[model samples]
Target: MDMLSCDLDRTNEIPLYEQLYLYIKREIIEGRLHYQTKLPSKRKLADFLEISQNTVEAAYEQLTSEGYLEVLPRKGYFVMASEDLEYVGKLDVPIKTDNVKNESFRYHFHPSIIDTAGFPFQQWRKYAKNVMDERNSDLLLLGEPQGEFELRTEIADYLYHARGVKCSPEQIVLGAGIEILLQQLVLLWDAKTKYGVEDPGYHLIPRIMKTYGRDLYPLQVDNSGVKVSEIARAGIDVVYVTPSRHFPYGTILSVNRRNKLLNWAAEADGRYIIEDDYDSEYRYSGKSIPSLQSMDQKGKVIYMGSFSKSLMPSIRISYMVLPHQLMERFRSELSFNNSSVSRMDQHILAQFMRHGDFGKHLNRMRKIYRRKLEKITEMLKHYADKIQVIGENSGLHIVLVVQNGLDETLLVKKAETANIRVYPLSQYTFEKKYEGPPQIILGFAGIPEEDLDDAITSLMKSWGI
Candidate 1:
C-alpha cells in the first residue's frame, strides 16, 4: 500500500496534532489501512515528519478513542474493519494539480433529486418477480417499437380515467423518455422548420433543437402560460408548450389561452404543436384540466407524456400520443431510425398498470407528496416578508423570489458551505439581457419532511434574512 502523505505547514494556525488526527482518521475510514493492518510506530512517524513524539501519540490516542483503530497490549494499534465506517472513502481530491489554471464553464441546473429512501422497494420487487414469472416468448423477444401493445393500452386507459385525456392505444407511441421523444420529433420534422419555444422555459429544448440546425423563436410567457398571440405572430411551424404546469414558473395555462393556442396552430397551415405534459399528475388543487391533445379537432397537437416524474427516474419510459393524420409518417420515420424503449420494462409496467397497482402507488405517493408540499409552504410562509414563494399549488419544486440587490451567487455559496443545495432561476434563461428579481428553485419532493424545517432555517441563516 502507498503511504498516505500530508503537508504540515509550521506557519499555519491549526495545531499539528489535530491535523494529524484528521489525516489518520480519513486514511483509516478510506480502507487505505485495512482491517488489522499495523500502523507506523509513533517514533518512526514523528521522525519522518520532524514532529515530536507527543504530538504523534496525541493523534493516535484521539483516533483510537473514536473507534477508527484498536490498540492491543504491547503490539501498538491496527486499523478497524471496513464495516465499522459509515462512509467508505476519503474526500475526492480536486481534478487539477494547479488550482490557478482552472477553466470556467457555463452553469447548469442540478438534476432532479428524488428521495430514493422512500421508494416502495418491497412492492417493486414483488411486481418485478411476478413479471418474470409470467413471462412469455414476446417478453424475451424484440417487441414492437411502439412498445408492448399491452403497455400502450394500459397507458391509454390510465390517461383517460386520471387526466381526462381522450386517446386510444394506437395513438400512444412509447419511447425511452422525454429526451428520446424530442429527438424522434426533430427527426420526423424537417430540419429547416422553425420551432417556437417558451422564453425562460425548460433550457433543454433550445439546446436539443439547435443540435438539428432548426431555427428557434423564444416565445414569451406570463401568468396565463405561453402567449398564444405572440406565438401566432412568430410564424413558427412548430410550437412546444407545457400547458399542464409551466416549468419553473408552475403556472397552469388558462382554458381560454389553451383554446386560442390550438386555434392558431390549426390556422397556421398544418403547423404542429408539441405539448410536454411532464408533472401534471401531482396537482394539489381543483380538478385536473384536460390536455390540449383532447381539444385538437384539427390534429395539430402531438402530446408527450413521461413516467419519470410520476414513477421513478430509472423507469425510462415515456410515450407520445400522435394524431391519426401524422401517425403513418411518424411510424415510418421511427422505423427507419430504430428508436424504441426496453421490452422488459414495458411489459413490467403494463402488468403493474393492469393489476391496478400503478394507480394505487400513485395515490399513495400523492398523499406523501402533499404532506411534503405543505411543510415547504409552511416554512416559506415563515419567511414571507423576505422571500416570495411562488408555484406552491403544484409540482415538485417551488421558486423563491428574493429581494433586489441580494447576491444569489453568494447566498448559494454560503448554503453549500452548510451542505444545503439550491438553484438560481436565471440559469434557465437563454437571453442575456433579460432581468428579474433574484430567485432560487428549491425542490422539496426529494428531501425528507422532517428535515424541511432545519433546511429552511439553514438557508435563512445563510442569506441572513
Candidate 2:
C-alpha cells in the first residue's frame, strides 16, 4: 500500500499538524483512500514533504486516536476498515428548493408555551454570573453524576414547603428536561413494566415510553382524573398521572381515587406510580392539591416536576424524586450516568431557590396569568351561548367546547380565517380519540393582554356568533 496525496497549509491560522490531520481525514471519508492502505512512514513523509518527523508524527497520532488509521506490529500505519469510518462521503448534487416562507398567525393559543413576559431574566443573569466566581471554580468541572448537591437540596426544600412532597437530596435526580428523566425512569425498571397513562394525557409520556419499549395502556380520564378501575383492570405495573392539574383538561385527581390508586399499587408487586406535579404552582382558585407522593406512605409514587412551566423553558432543568425502591436501583445500575444538566445552571437555580426568587416569580406569574384569564373569561362570555368553557380554574390554557354546530375541523378553519390559531383537544388522545365534544385549547399566557379583546372579536365575527 502506498500513501495517498497529503498536503498542509502553513499560512492558515490552523496548526500544521491539524491541517494535515483534516486533509488525511477528508481523503478517507471521500473514498480516495481505501481500506488497508498504508500511510507514509513519518520519517519518509517528513523527508518527502520537507517537514520535521515530529510534525508528521503528530498528524499520524491524531488520525490513529480517531480510529481513522491503525498500526500493525511490524507494518506501518494503515487505513482502518471502511465500515469503521465515522462519516460517509456524499455526492455534491445541486437541486431546486422551495423559497416559500411559512405563514404566521396573528393570535396563537398554543398550550405548551408559557408567559415569558414575567420571567426573571435580570435576576437569573445575576445568579448565573455569581456562579462563575473563583470560590465556585470547582463547579466548572463535572461535579456530581446525579446533579449538584446544592441544587438537589434546594429542590427538596422547595418541594416540601410548596407541594408537600417528602424527600431529601439523596432521592432527587436532575436532568435536562422531563423527557430525559422519563427515559431514565424507564431504563431503571427491573421487571415487565406495563405502563398506563391517561387517555388524553400529556402525549409525550406515551411516546417516550414507546421509545423505551414499554407496553402503554391508555386509561380514560373521567370527572376526577385517571380512572382507577381501568388501571386495576389493565394489570399495569406502572402508572403516570398529572394529578395536580391534568394537562389540557385541568382535572384534579380526587382524594377518593388517589387512595384506590395507592391501594392498587400496594396490592401488586413491582408497581409504581409516577405523579407528574407539573405546573402546580399557579392555582387561581381553591387550595393547591397536595402531591400524590405526599400522600403515599409506601413510597409508591415517583414525584416529577420541572421549572420549564414556572420559569423559562430554555433553562432545561427538570427533576424527579425517586422512591426508595427505585432509588436503590438507580444507584446500583444507572448511578454512573452523568447528569444531563450543566453544573453552572444547577448552581444558578440553587441560588435562585435559596434567595426565594423562584417563589416570588411564581407568585407574580400566578397573579399576572389570573388577571389574564379573568379578561379572557369575560371576553369568552360573549360566546357563552355557542361554546362551553372547561379547565379554566387552573393552568395556563382553557378548553372551549363549540356548542353551536362547528366540529373541531370547522372551528379551527373558522378561527384561522380571523388570523387566530387554535388547537384541537382530540390531538391529545391516544387511541381513545376523545369523542365526547369537539373542543379547542386556547392559551392566554403567551398572548398580549391588549390583543385579547381584538383576537376574541375577530373570532366572533369569523364564526358568525
lDDT of 2 by residue, 335-392 (tens): 8889999999888999999999999999999999999899999889978888788888
Per-residue accuracy of model 1 over 134-237 as CA lDDT, tens digit each = 44655776767777788999999998888767889988888887888888878877777888987778778877877888899988888999888887677789
Q: Highest lDDT among the candidates is held by which one? A: 2
Q: TM-score, each model?
A: 0.77, 0.77
Clashes of each: 0, 0
Q: After superposition, how far is residue 294 of candidate 1 from its true place, in Å?
A: 1.5
Which residue pairs come into collision in candidate 1?
Answer: none
Give the C-alpha miss distance for residue 128 in model 1, angstroms.
1.2
Give the Cα error of residue 136 in candidate 1, in Å: 2.9
Candidate 1 residue 363 Cα shift, in angstroms, is 1.2
Where does the lowest 10-residue lDDT sum fall in candidate 1? 98-107
Looking at model 1, residue 88 earns an lDDT score of 53
